[model samples]
Target: MVFEEGRIKQWLINYINPGMAFNDIKSVVTHYTALHPTKETYIFNDGTPMELVNLQGTIPVTYKSVVYNIPIIIWLMDTHPQHAPLCYVKPTPTMNIKVSKYVDQNGKIYLPYLHEWAQDKSELLGLVQVMIVTFSEQPPVFAKVKPKEALYHPSINNSFPNSVFMQQPPYPTHSPYPQPSYQGMMPQAAQSGYPPGGYPLYPTPYPAYPPQPSSMINTGTGTIKEEHIKESLLTAIEEKLMRRMKEEFQQNQAELDTLKRTQDELKQGSLKLQVVLERLEKEKSDLDKNITVLKDKEQELDKAIERLSNQESMDVDDAVITTAPLYKQLLNAFAEEAALEDAIYYMGEALRSGVIDLEVFLRQVRTLSRKQFMLRALMQKCRQKAGLTVV
Candidate 1:
């Protein structure tokens, strides 16, 4: 697919915030796309689907002074900078994956750079560089061996599509020791399984081993020594033991990683509990202080109640005693006015029941009203003299 740089930028600008994160993404995308174009898609993992930008291409790696191209795919998640990108070794059909400590059986690449990815420090470009360097030390894939005829016959090897060769690397690139080629059968060098111009140029470092004589194959049992058989058995046992040890080591490493993550979670939980405990302690202290204050206030109220209960009630005359003569006269006048009002009210009730003569009742009411009015006037005068408010 043609790489649409504009479309990719537009998508990023629309989705990512315009900040350090955006700039970091733009810089990496721009730099990487110079060598290879990008592809966009929505990808789903164990989690929810996300729109991702992926670069599927080869990066150059120099191994033993010979430059080789390693085919790989880098997936940039939507939450870039915050999280590291996913890297995978993309091998062709003829290429079988070579698993190492850095590259898993699934062709998923793992690196210290990826594991320790920091938003402030890490970049996508650096990650690609790391992958290149790591793969150069140990290539992640090797070309699958063809049939003996294809390997030995030049004409048969050339019959395969050149385009297929262009995509895949040559056979047995994972072997630390040099591969033994048959120069006697095929003279001219061509794509073992890879391209002519070296999409990944894997040159054989050692010359082909001489073919074994037919006479040796017929006398194999006679030539085979007891020591050689024992040695072969020991070598096989050692290899099996080594393989089992490696598997156990990988499993233990995974468990250790899980334990580390669990430890971190426990640390966070402990901090939260500490904070809660501190807040609870503060609340408890405040409650204790409040209880002390309430107890003190309760003691004061009880003392006031006890004092009032123990004291004798004052006599009416002593309670109503005034310091000034005008206050005393006002008090006496008020009492007389209230008594006369009651007497007048009772006389009116008696007249209504025909118990008193109308003439006597009217005379008594008139006298009582005159006396009440005089007493009220005297009370007002006395209050005014005493500097009190009169109603």
Candidate 2:
């Protein structure tokens, strides 16, 4: 739970950047937490052995000179000094998209910055700023939004010709804006000579002129109408682009399916060929075994015929044959019983033959004592055969 002073100082440096603009987040700033888990049961939570920093903020992303505030959460993992943090875009529940390369239907976003994370020099604030700017290139295709109402500041889209007329004051207003009355009253005042509150010193009055039409202004600059046309044009272009993208996606999907089907067929053919190859190998082995059996049987038959032809001499060879069979049987029985020491002998043979690696033998020998394994003479013979050092 304790954080080293050096690590904590490095983390605190992420609060802001002197060179970059950091959009202030409304979420409450929280203290850092570190986890060191000794049990697998808490690996994802308390048992984590790294520092995890969680950041919640409205990431300011700009598109077409307009700014949008996208809410997101970032998780800096324990390997953060060496690993990139996890980022998630959190939109309102009702908003969802059907398709996007990075942002999911739930508005969770993925960016390329984390993919190329630099452990030695990477900082959290710098990373978030990069992500915010990257989103401008391809804003999320919203699943739902009002046609005119967007999450962007509306001032950029203002179509008024005279900006000064509609400029907002630095304070809030409680009522609707009053209509412009000066245009209508200007003509009336000129006709009455001088101003509405006439000064008494001026007895002379200008001759009354013909009254102009009382029709209100037209905002003759056509700024609002021009804006409507631009909006319509943009909508048309967007629709066309969407259709083209859909068409391309379907084509790619179809091609992928065809390739997948071909791959599956090739795999099936390969499996069949493998089965045929295995069957042929088994048959070849069986044929070789049968040939060996037939050769043995043929030798036995030849011997029997030979014995039949030499029946008269068979009695003369009986004394020699019986004595040889008794000695051979005694040797075979002894060999079988003495084979109990074969494992250690094989080890010695393998060591001498270089079949057992030196390092492996040395490691195993460290666990083995001479007295526990063999008689002193046998041990000496094995050691001599294996070229092992005296212990």
Candidate 2 lDDT by residue in tens digits, 1-391: 3324354445435433312111111112211121111100102323333233445435556766766555455654444445565555544333332224455433444455564467565666566667667666655432243334322324323343332222211211111112121121111233335344321112222222111211122345424454554554576466556655655676688789999999999999999999999999999999999999999999999999998898765564354442354344444433443563465566667888999987876665543434334444454554455565634
* Best of the candidates, TM-score: 1
Scored against the true structure, residue 251 in model 1 reaches a CA lDDT of: 63
Candidate 1's C-alpha runs over 4 A off are 1-6, 13-25, 29-34, 42-51, 81-84, 91-112, 115-122, 141-391
lDDT, each prediction: 0.61, 0.45
Candidate 1, residues 1-391: lDDT per residue as tens digits? 3455567676566344425444554565566643443434433433334445556566676666766556676666666767776777766555666655666555667677876677889987788878778877877766554555334543223444323322321121122111222111111124223354223332322122112111111132434345654565576466556655765676689789999999999999999999999999999999999999999999999999999799898676776668877777888899899999999999999999999999999999999999999999998888888878978
Error of 2 at 308 (Å): 3.4
Model 2: lDDT equals 0.45
- TM values, all candidates: 0.41, 0.30
lDDT of 1 at 184: 15
Q: In model 2, where do residues sit more than 4 Å from their true spots?
A: 1-54, 58-71, 74-130, 135-220, 226-289, 292-313, 316-391
Error of 2 at 40 (Å): 22
How high is the lDDT of residue 357 in model 1? 98
